[model samples]
Target: MSGLLALLDDVAGIAKMAAASVDDVVGQAAKAGAKAAGAVIDDAAVTPKYVHGFEARRELPIVWRIARGSIFNKLVILLPVAMLLSVFAPWMIPPLLMLGGGYLCFEGAEKIWHKLSPGGQGHGGGDVIPEDAAHLEEEKVQGAIKTDFILSAEIMTIALAALPESGLWFKAAALGLVGLGITVLVYGSVALIVKADDVGLHMAAAGRLRATRALGRAIVRGMPGFMTGLTWVGTAAMLWVGGSIILHGLAELGWHAPEEMIHHAAEAVAHLAPADLRGAVGWAVKAVIDGALGLMLGFVLIPLATKVISPAIRAVTGRAAKGH
Candidate 1:
C-alpha cells in the first residue's frame, strides 16, 4: 500500500509539471504570434484571392485545401527547421531574421513601386475564369501553398526569435503551438472572408427581417472596400515590422546609431505630448521612423532582387517569371 501511494504521488507530480509546461507553451506561443502579426495579417489578407471565381460551393473546400497545405508548411516543415537552428546554430537566427525582415521590406516596397510606376506589375488575383477547371484549381492551390511556405517561414522565425530561453522540448512545443495556432487563425479567417459574400447574398435574399436583409446587403457591398483596406493595413504593417526588426538586428550586431537615434527622437517627441498619450505618441513616432527606413532599404534591394536574384531563381528552378 505504501509503495502504491508513493508511485501515485510521483505520477501526480509529473502530471502537474506537464500541465505547467503546457501553460508556458500557450503563453509563449501567444506572445510570439503577436510579434509576427505583420506577416500573419499579410497571410490572412493574401489568401482570399486564391478562391476567387470558384463556385460558391467550392470556395470553402478550396480554402480547406489551402488551410491543410498551410498547416503542413508550418508544422511539418518550418517547426523542425526552427528547432534544428535553435539546437545546432542558434547564432544564425539574427542574420536569418534580418534576411526575412529585408524580404518583407522588399515585398512592401515592390508593391509601392508598382503603384507609383507606370504599368507597374499589377496584383493579379487568380484567374477571373478558369482556363481549365481541374488544372486551374490545382495550380491555384499549389501557388497558395508556396506563398504560405514563405510567409510561414517568416512567421516561424519571428516566433522563434521572440521566445525566451528554454529547453529544446519546451521551445519545440512553443513553436508547434505558434505554427499550428497561426495557420488556423490565418486560414480560418480566410475561409470566413471567402464565404462571407455567399452568406451575405443568402441573407439578403432570404432574411425575413428588414434589418437583417439590409445588413446582408451592407456586407456584400462592403467586402471589396474592406479587402482593399486590409491590404493597405498589411502593407503598412510589413514595413513597420520589417524595419523595426532590421533596426533591432543591426543594434544586436553592434550598429547602434540608428536605433539610438530613433529612440532619442521618439522620447523627445513623447515628452511634448500629454502624459496620458505619451506612450502612444512615442510608439507611433518610432513606427513611422521604422517604416520609412524599411521603405528606403526595400527600394535599395529592389534592383538587386530583380536583376540578380530573380534570374538566379529562374535558372535554378527552370521556370520563367509568371507575368511579362
Candidate 2:
C-alpha cells in the first residue's frame, strides 16, 4: 500500500538523521579529545607510578579501580559542572581554562626544576611504608584518584571549551563520549605500559621460539627507557598545550600582542620552508615559543606558589580544621 511505502520512507529518513547525529557526536568528541591531549597524556604517564611495587596480579585491578574513579570524576561530577558552566556561566570558561593551563605549566616546570636542582626531593621519596600492605595500596589508589580529579577537571573543561556551540543534549553527548573515550584510552595505555615488562618476562621464559625469547628480552630491557621517554614526552606536551591554552585565553580576553607576535614570527620562519612543509614548520615554531613562554611563567609562579600560596593555603586549612 502507499501508506506502507510512506512509512518505510519516513523510517529511512529517521535512520539517516540518527546516523548523521552519531557522526557529529563522534567528530566533536575527537576534536575535544585532541584539545585535551596534554592532560590526557599526563594522566597516562602518571598513573603507572601508583602501581609501582605492587604485586603483579594486583596491578591491573588497581588500574581498573583508578580508571573507574576517573570515569566517575569525568562523567558523574565534572560533566554536570561543565554543563552548568556552559549554561549559566559560559563566560567563566576561558579563565578556568587558563587556570588549568597554568597548573600544567607549573607541574611541568616543577618536574624539570626538581631534576636540575641539587638535593631536590623526587616524587618517589619520603613514603612511610605502613605495616599493612593492603592499607598502603588503598592509600595510593585514593591518592591517585584525588590527583586524577584535577587532571580530569582540566580535561573536561578543555573539552567543553573546544565543543562548538550546540544544544544541551548535543553538548552532553559529545562530552560523555569524550570522557568515556579518553578514560578508555588513558587507562588502556596504562594497563599495557604497566604489564609490558611482565609480559616480556613471561615471553622470555616461556616463549617456544628463540626469536620470541630474544624479542621478549628486548622488551624487558627497553621498558625502563621507554617509560623515561614517555615521561619526558608527557612533560613537553604539558608545557606546549598549557602555553598554547594560556596564549589563546589571553587573546580571547583582549590581549592580542603575544599571539600576534607569535603568529608573525611563525610566518617569518615558515617562509624559508618548502610550501608543503611550511604549515608544519610554522606550527612547530609557534609551539616552541609557547613552551618557552610557559616555562618562564612557570618559573615566575614557582616561588610564588611555594613561598606564599602554599603556606597561605595550609594556614587556612589548618585553622579551619582546628575550628571544626
Candidate 3:
C-alpha cells in the first residue's frame, strides 16, 4: 500500500538523522578529548604513584577505585558545573581556563625545579606512611582522588570550551562521551604501568620460549625508563598546553600582542622549511615558545605560591579548624 511505503521512508529518514547525530557527537568528543590531552596525560602519569607501595595484587583494585572516583569527579561534579557555566556564566570560561592553565604551568615548573635543585624530592615523596596498611592505602586513594578532582576540572573545562555551540542535550552527550573515554584511557594506562613489572617478571619466569623470556626481561628493564619518559612528556605537554591556553585567553581578553608575536615568530620559523613541512614546523615553534613562556611564569609563581599563598591558606584553615 502507499501508506506502508510512506511509513518505511519516514523511518529510514529518522534513522539517517539519528546516525548523523551520533557521528557529530563522536566527532566533537574526539576533538574535545584532544584538547584535554595535557590533563589526561598528567592524570595517567600521576596515578601510578599512588599504588607504589601497595601489594601487587592490590594495585589493580586501587587503580579501579581511583578510576571510579575520577569518573564521579568528571561526570557527577564537573560535567554539571561546566553545563551551568556554559548556560549562565559563559563569560567566565576564559578566566577559569586561564586559572587552570596557570596551575598546569606551576605544576610543571615546580617539577622541573625539583629535578634541578639539590636534595629536591620528586613525585611520590612526603607521603605519611601510617602504621596500618589499610589506613595507608585509604589515605593514598583519597589523596589520589583529591588530586584527580583538580585535573578532572581542568579537563572538563577545556573540553567544554572546545565544544561548538549546540543544544544542552547535545553538549551533554559529547561531554559524557569525552569524560568516559578519558577515564577509561587514563586508568587503564595506569593499571598497565603499575602492573607492568609484575607481568614482566611473570613472563620472565614462566614463559614457555627463550624469546618470550628475553622479551619479558626487556620489558622489566624498560619500564623504569618508560615511566621516566612518560613523566617528562607529561610535564612538557602541561607546559605547552598551559602556555597556549594562557596566550589564547589573553588574546580573548583583548591583549593580543603576545599571541601575535608568537604567531609571527612561528611563521618566520616555518618559512625556512619545505612547504610540506612548514605547518608542522610552525606548530613546533609555537609549542616551544609557549613552553618557554610557561616555564618563566611558573618560576615567577613558585615563590609566590610557596611563601605567600601557602602560608596564608594554612593560617586561614588553621584558624577555621580551631574555631570548629
Candidate 4:
C-alpha cells in the first residue's frame, strides 16, 4: 500500500538522522578528547604512583578501585554538573575553567615549593609507604579515590569546555562520550602499566629465545625508571597546561599582553633553531614560560592559603581547638 511505503520512508529518514547524530557525537568527542590530552597524560602518570607501595598481588586491585572511583566521579558527579552548567550557567564555563587551571597551577607549584623548602609539609607522595599484611587497604583506597576525584574533575571540566557549542542533547552525548572514552583511556592504561612488570617477569623467566628474554628483562629493569620519568613529565605537564589555560582564559576576558608577549618570545626562540626543530623549540620555550608563571602563582597562594586561610577555615568550622 502507499501508506506502508510512506511509513517505511519516514522510518528510514529517522534512522539516517540518528546515524548522522552519532557521527557528530563521535567527531566532537574525539576533538574534545584530543584537547584534553595533557590532562589525560597527567592522570595516567599520577595514578601509578598511588599503587607503588603495594604488594604485586595488590597493585591491580588498587588500580581497579581507583578506576571505579574515577568512573563514579565522571558519571555521578561531573556529568550531571556539566549538564546543569550547560543549561543554566553556560556563561560561567570560562571562569570555572580558569579556577580549575589556577588550582592546577597551585598544586604543581606547591610540589616545587616543598622540594626547595625541606621543612614544608610533606604529602604522602614523598613518603616510603611500606606494604604490610596488617596494612589498612581501605584507607589507601579512600585516599586514592579522593585524589582521583580531583583529577577527574579537571579532566571532565577540560573536556566540557572543549566541546563544540551544540544543542543540549548533542552536548550531553558528546560529553558522555568524552567521559567514557577518557575514563577507559586513563584507567585502561593504568591497568596495563601496573601489570607490565608482572608480564615482564613472566616473559623474562619463560622466554625460550634469548632476544625475547633479554627484552623482557630490559622491560622489568626499565619500568621503575620509566615510571619516575612519567611522574616528572606529568608534573611539568600540569604546570604547562594549567598556566596556559589561565593565560588563554585571561586573553578571552580581555587581557592579551601576557599571551602576546609569550608568543613573540617563543617565536624569537624558534628562530634560533633549525627549520626542523623550530616548532619543537617554540613549544618548549612557551611551556617553560607558562610553567614559571604557574610556579610564581602557586608560591604566592601557598603561604596565604596555609597561614591565613587555614586558621580562618578552622575557626569557622570550630576546629581551631583541635589544631593543638
Model 1 alpha-carbon miss at residue 211, Å: 0.3
**Model 3, 1-324: lDDT tens per residue?**
999999999999999999999999999999999999889999999999899877677889899999999999999999999999999999999999999999999999999999989877555545344566688889889999999999999999999999999999999999999999999999999988998999899999999999999999999999989999999999999999999999999999999999999999999999999999999999999999999999898898899899999999999999999999
Q: 49-137 in candidate 2: lDDT tens per residue? A: 99887778889999999999999999999999999999999999999999999999998899889888987645553443446668978
Give the clash total for candidate 1: 0
Q: Model 4: per-residue lDDT, tens digit, 209-286?
A: 998899899999999899877866777788888888899889989999999999999999999999999999999999
User: Model 1 clash pairs?
Assistant: none
TM-score per candidate: 0.93, 0.96, 0.96, 0.85
Model 2, C-alpha of 166: deviation from truth (Å): 0.6
Sequence-dependent TM-score of model 3 = 0.96
Write down the lDDT that model 4 would get: 0.83
Error of 1 at 10 (Å): 4.4
Question: How many pairs in model 3 have backbone atoms within 3 A of each other, for residues 3 or more apart or on separate chains, i.e. clashes?
Answer: 0
Query: Candidate 1: minimum summed lDDT over ten consecutive residues — where?
Result: 315-324
Residue 104 error for model 3, in Å? 0.4
Regarding lDDT, does 3 or 4 come out ahead? 3
How close to the true structure is residue 213 of candidate 4, measured as C-alpha lDDT? Answer: 93
Model 3 error, position 184 (Å): 0.4
Ten-residue region with minimum lDDT total, candidate 2: 121-130
